[model samples]
Target: MTICRLEVSNPAFTPDNTQFVTVHSSHLNRRHDVSIYNVNAQTENVPIIVLMHGVYGNHWVWMGLGGIHHVYERLRSEHKISEFVLVMPSDGGLRDGSAYLPTKGHGNYEQWIMDDVITAVQKTVENVTINSPLYLSGLSMGGYGALRLGAKYAEQVSGISAHSSITDLLELTEFVDHSLDAYDCRNLHESNIVYWMNKNKNKLPPIRFDCGREDILYSGNIRFVEELKSNGIPHIYETFEGEHSWEYWHTHIVQTFEFFSDIQTHRR
Candidate 1:
């Protein structure tokens, strides 16, 4: 069990309950950046929440310009949450994000996260175990990653939260340029959150997602929710007053953490 290589120095402290570490992933053959925020480092057996970033964004997007750590600190301080570790990983070496997929020639980005990233975290963080509860959440492209992978790997996670997710990878045409052959396109479609959720309905974990009314992907999110409803699958879907910007994601991420917290409580 070789976790990814630690390519960076020891954890650097900041005022916002955050730490930065870089790990080299053999899967991707590159160094992957990760940002961790431990609300209570001494706490044990708490869920590890992986907060993935959207396209053109690295691990820093959530805590940096988005001020997510600040919001999370506020929520935790206000007694809205129990302590949890936040793992933010960069979608490395992709021109327009990997969509966290294992595409041809590029590399197995999925393995990079599921194995290399998780192993690196366990090795870097004290007392982290294979049996520790896990959760996933992300925004935009990250939302796609969280929802799709969360469902695809449902056995490994308790729940998932997606914000402004690209429920359908075809929707990505609006944002990125691609010259995919039929197989690549089909493979990507297969990984669509809605598609995979249906395929894994029996194993689906608690799922919640929200999108802003002003977002271009709002219709897609609504359609996805409808599909879930039609199939008798359970999930939480919300529409708020903002757009696809970080402002919307930053403000609402607290709701996501709260959702995961509630799931942890009831499952106990």
Candidate 2:
């Protein structure tokens, strides 16, 4: 594993440095990079939120284009919700996005996140204990990942929130140009958000997700919510004014952090 630290001198910010660790995945047979935020504080038992990125995005998407650093600063300074570690990891750059799925032979992106990525973070990041609370949020394909993996590994995370999430492989391949030959269509159909939630009904974590009014995935989000209701699963779903753009995600992710914070407080 390769480790590096980025120290930024921003007079207006409290924590000016971000650490990055690249973990070699036996599943993917490659090195995956994870960008960490706010590791300086003594966050012993704080919840760690993993922010997965959309297709065509890398680990830096949250920190760079998503302006998460600005949002983190605002939360700590203004909202006083400090002491959580933010982990941003890539999807192994599988064509478009891996959908965080495990292929038969090539590599297992799902295991890379649920197994390799989390393990690597706990080892490399200081002050992060094995018992630190975990949460997940993502957008687009990343949203699909967080929801599916969060359910599949229900015991690992405390809660999950997704924005503009793709509910199925069909919807995902519609927007991207990559061929999804590696994904099992049968498995994809079975792993649809609603399907997975139904399969893991009793084991689900606290769940919430939102979609923009103009987002192409808006209809899918609505359908998934309906399925949840029909299946007696409780969650928070809302519609906001925006589209499937960075501006939309950047503004609303703050609410996700707050939601996780609430869960953390109540659990204590």
Candidate 3:
């Protein structure tokens, strides 16, 4: 795992505004590059939030839309959370259509995130204390990753927030008419939500999910909620009138932050 402290150059913003130190690693378990957003706050022990980006989205995806600056500034300034840090790494270049899945040639992405990437982040933050709790959230493809990780390790995270998550992979596959032969046996039982949920039935984490009503992925989102209800899984689900655009994603991300923040406070 490679982690560094370097500033990104974005001419659009002022020197200071663009001066963000990024920590990224590329060679952990052959997983996707692990990139994190260090707010440069003045605290040794900060709460850490592992956020992921949607398909084809980079770490900068949430920078402009999700009031990202506000999210960072608010948490840091208000001391609204525990030792706080935001870790956002893309699912490789799989931002657009990869679905955060591991095809035949691809390596084990789920294990990479669950193990290497997470270990790298924890190790990089040298001052992390036992009190530090990890929080996670994501949008679209990222949304799927965030919850999957949390559900996979319910004992580790405080909570999870998902924006426009394609929760029901079985339905999503049919809706998109995509092929999953590379990952599964050409059946939903292998990698879709229908299977993912069953695998995590006894240990699913607290969930918050939302989507735009006009978005084509609305069906998949609603179906996820239905499955949760049928299985008596506790979660928060809602819908807003909009399309599959940055506008909707940006609006919901802030809400996601609020939800995560509240979880920390209540749990503590």
Candidate 4:
């Protein structure tokens, strides 16, 4: 990963247990910010969860809107989950969204997440290292990114969890105002979630996803689950009672935290 320059915020100036990092990435040829939450900075060998946001959202969405830091703190205090460093990153600053895919003219948003984001976290967080377990997660378009990228880079990820995901690239049209041509890539398969999951099926890490029963993407998620079943891919899928609102994600994200914590405990 080629980072032209790096900048980290002063912890004292930021909210408790949270900091921001800015990386000038060669992949995107622009500076992007990442919001990090480390409840206990002195703890080492903890897992890192990279939370990608959906369309029209930036790095602060997870904490600012979802209150993920508060969720993490509550989960830890209640002894329901293990320690983790939360990393929230922007989606390459494309029009409405980047879909976290590499485009011919739009720069490699995929590489920005798979490479630059990880590198930034390793550098800026003292508790995070190259060897620490990494988890991928997100909401809506971000959910698609987590599922696709986690499958494509299975060897590097420990687990994946997505909420109300867009199963295919075409689904982006329903949410964004930009034309599909903006996401054009040499290999169409690169934009497909099932393609990567099938290609790396054998090496895939633990996978799970959920959708609100009333979400517009609910039908797509059901079809996706069926495809996974027919292909014999191992995953966990569930439906909740809510819509595609922040309230739904805020309440359900606890499931993902618990899932990751269970995986970590088993690994130990």
Candidate 5:
């Protein structure tokens, strides 16, 4: 049995309702951090949105750099969205990025997000429970994680959204200096986004992805969307007018929140 332990800390820089948690994951045999924004602690049955970060980013990037907390507040205040607990988790501290795939030597970064992170949130947050609806969203490499993992574990996730995503394992070469061999796993399908989506197409939750027109990854995202259409996989894809930067993610993250809100409304 793998025993995972957690320690909670309040980072001084975090906004009023955010809590930073460090988990000693047996899967990775190292400590990873997760930043949670839980304004709906007193509210029951609030959905949990797990946001993953891309290359060169940590757990706080979503809130500290992207100001997602501010966006959530505005959406909730205006009743444009349902109450949600935001969870931002680090990508297992690999090189420039982990690709969120399980590697032979580096341990299972995939489980670190899918299992340990969710378990920690349930244990720490008062209102988040096993019953809370689970949503996944991310950007760039993180977007790959959200799309792949959400499809692989369709039964556990309610919806998925991504922006400026790396659609294949080879795409990591564009951003990272390391060799792609570091991310190789026995099951090749684990590293391919379209494979998992097609394998679990019947069970996949509502998925949405977008790419900026000028971003380096725009062509790859276009190819991915075309493949999805050819395979009859269900998803939402959009093209925006920005490049791959925090400016783009921060401006368009509202669409992700609103997309999840729409899912929640329809579920009820």
Candidate 6:
């Protein structure tokens, strides 16, 4: 795969992560602007961690704590995490934040992820190939995207880390009784998972999740963990001291990166 970096100048953009870029994908055939950081090229295929944001959020959330560049550079030279590229793409415009869902008469938010976004990563980054495999991780809206896409296309993603993520939309709709606004996209039902599993249940990827005890989204994460456990699914579910804020996500993302690297080693 061939990759190239792009300069982003979108009026709707937000400042979240350390260093950001836009990658144009040729495999899935789509144009995507992705924010990437902490990249290190090696002779073999490098492991990548796709960082996603919640509703009404942009790539800048990763940089909200003001340490993305420092962390990225440190990981590259000291921690050897330089082989991992942090990617944050435009899932969709903020007004249409449907938890990365497909809205009617609006935009195909899921496509923004399922489409050539992966191809764009393959092209823009060196050694990060597509149609091969990847480690998926996300927060909130991104958490939903990571699980949905990972389940739907088990052939692509090898593992998933969904932090404070809502898995079952049908269950999520129990709380959201409003229209399918950008916010409405946050609720996910269990039926959605079943549908994807039915299509590829024979080969579902591994998943892990965590949520704060005080978070409003805590119940959703717990319920998801319960269901997965009841069905004999092995997943990592724990309660951490945090809320639905970047401070929590920022701290958690680092650990998630290590988890992703371990999975990649297992795959190798």
Q: Which stretches of model 2 miss by more than 4 angstroms?
A: 1-15, 80-82, 184-190
The prediction achieving the highest TM-score against the true structure is 4
Candidate 4 stretches with Cα past 4 Å from truth are none
What do the candidate models score in CA lDDT, each in turn?
A: 0.80, 0.81, 0.63, 0.90, 0.90, 0.63
Supply candidate 3's per-residue lDDT for 202: 70
Indicate the residue-level lDDT of 5 in model 3: 34
Worst 10 residues of 6 by lDDT: 182-191
- lDDT tens digits by residue: candidate 6, 1-68: 43334454433464433345665543323344567664344535666666677666676666555355
RMSD of 3: 4.5
Identify the runs in model 5 with alpha carbons over 4 angstroms from their true place: 1-3, 10-14
Query: Would you estimate the TM-scores of all the predictions?
Result: 0.92, 0.91, 0.77, 0.97, 0.96, 0.77
Model 1 ranges with Cα > 4 A deviation: 1-4, 11-16, 180-189
Q: Write the per-residue lDDT of candidate 2 for residues 1-268, one digit (tens) a residue.
A: 4222322223255336577767767778877788888766586765688899998999989989999878878887886564688889888877777888877576888878877777776776677778888898899998998898888777788999999999777798767886777765446454566777777889889999999999999998888888889999888998899999999999999878888878877887
Clashes of each: 0, 0, 9, 0, 0, 19
Off by over 4 Å in 6: 1-19, 22-32, 65-82, 94-96, 170-178, 181-191
Tens-place lDDT per residue, model 5, 43-91, is 6877899999999999999988999888888988998988899999999
Q: Model 2's lDDT to the true fold?
A: 0.81
Give the worst 10-residue stretch by lDDT in candidate 2: 2-11
Estimate the TM-score for candidate 1. 0.92
- The alpha-carbon lDDT assigned to residue 110 of candidate 2 equals 81
Tens-digit lDDT string for candidate 3 (1-268): 3433323334356333332323343332232444455544345556677777775577556765565756666665776544456666656553144555555655445554555556656665554545567777887777877776677667777788888886754434533444655453344454554355567767665678898999877888887788778877788888998887787876666677677777766864
Encode model 4's per-residue lDDT on 104-197: one tens digit a residue. 6868898999899999888878888898999999999999999999999999999999999999888889998877887755585878788888
Question: Which candidate, 1 or 6, would have the higher TM-score against the true structure?
Answer: 1
